[model samples]
Target: MEIIAEFGSSLLIVGCVLGFFMAWGIGSNDVANAMGTSVGAKALTLTGAILVACVFEFAGAYLAGGEVTETIRKGIIDPSLLASTPHYLVYGMLASLLAAGIWLLVASIFGWPVSTTHSIVGAIVGFSAVCIGSESVNWGKVGSIASSWVVSPVLAG
Candidate 1:
């Protein structure tokens, strides 16, 4: 009600909607993948898995989601000169959320095992590159993220 009314700003309103879509897409696909194995192995019934995921997802969102959101807002793109033109950051975020949500939906429909993290990161990078120029992006952070993607599996195996 009031929260909905609070979205009087166009970008904030759209961002809220797109954020919902992204969360729904992520929940439907990524959460299923995370819980599938346990359900398959009979360690958790489908209901049990869903319930567990609901608890943990809510917890994670409440606990760490703010940090992630803050990072996405200010970490990836340098907003040093955005004081006069502050709308681009909102535009970029809206675009990133929509892109990531759409990518997740497409990948899930095609039965592809896509990582939501990667999708969001890629969307942010692409948006930054196109909208703000590649130089505005923090390539060093991107490089670290990419390297972890490569190193994680090697270490896990």
Candidate 2:
């Protein structure tokens, strides 16, 4: 069926895309941000930060990232579910990434402190709302995730 094929293709394409994003996002957001503070403090030169960032990032991701991949759901959604999923989901996701990227670039250019992790999650939710109607979204998931930001401040404090 043409519908079935379309659904399959969309699911696979999006999954692969999201997988690539996960890896890059981890290296870019997690590793780079971690060392950004040191660079800001002038303890490490930009080149030094980048080189060490490359090494430690690769080591951490290649070594421990497997644990993270293990926790991801490969194909929890059935093809039937896929068929019901709107094509706009893909568009929304792309837009979300675009927003986050633009935000991060602008913030970095202006030397404003912002959180990439927060931006990504916000992008996803923003796009999710565009794809599925806001009424269809599970607020519980959003709420729980928001709790992470709240908890982080308490944890840091």
- Candidate closest to the true structure, highest TM-score: 1
Candidate 2 regions off by >4 Å? 1-33, 40-42, 59-82
**Colliding residue pairs in candidate 1:** none
Stretch of 10 with least lDDT, candidate 2: 71-80
Tell me the spans in candidate 1 whose CA falls farther than 4 Å from its real position. 1-8, 155-157
Q: What tens digits encode model 2's per-residue C-alpha lDDT throughout 64-124?
A: 8775334211111112233455455545545666677767766665666677657766776
Q: Residue 148 lDDT in model 1?
A: 85
Residue-by-residue lDDT tens digits, candidate 1, 64-157? 9998777667677787745555566666777889999999999888878888889998898888788769998888877877898999999999
Candidate 2 clashing pairs? none
Structural similarity to truth (TM-score) of each candidate: 0.86, 0.60
| Residue 41, candidate 1: C-alpha displacement in angstroms | 1.5
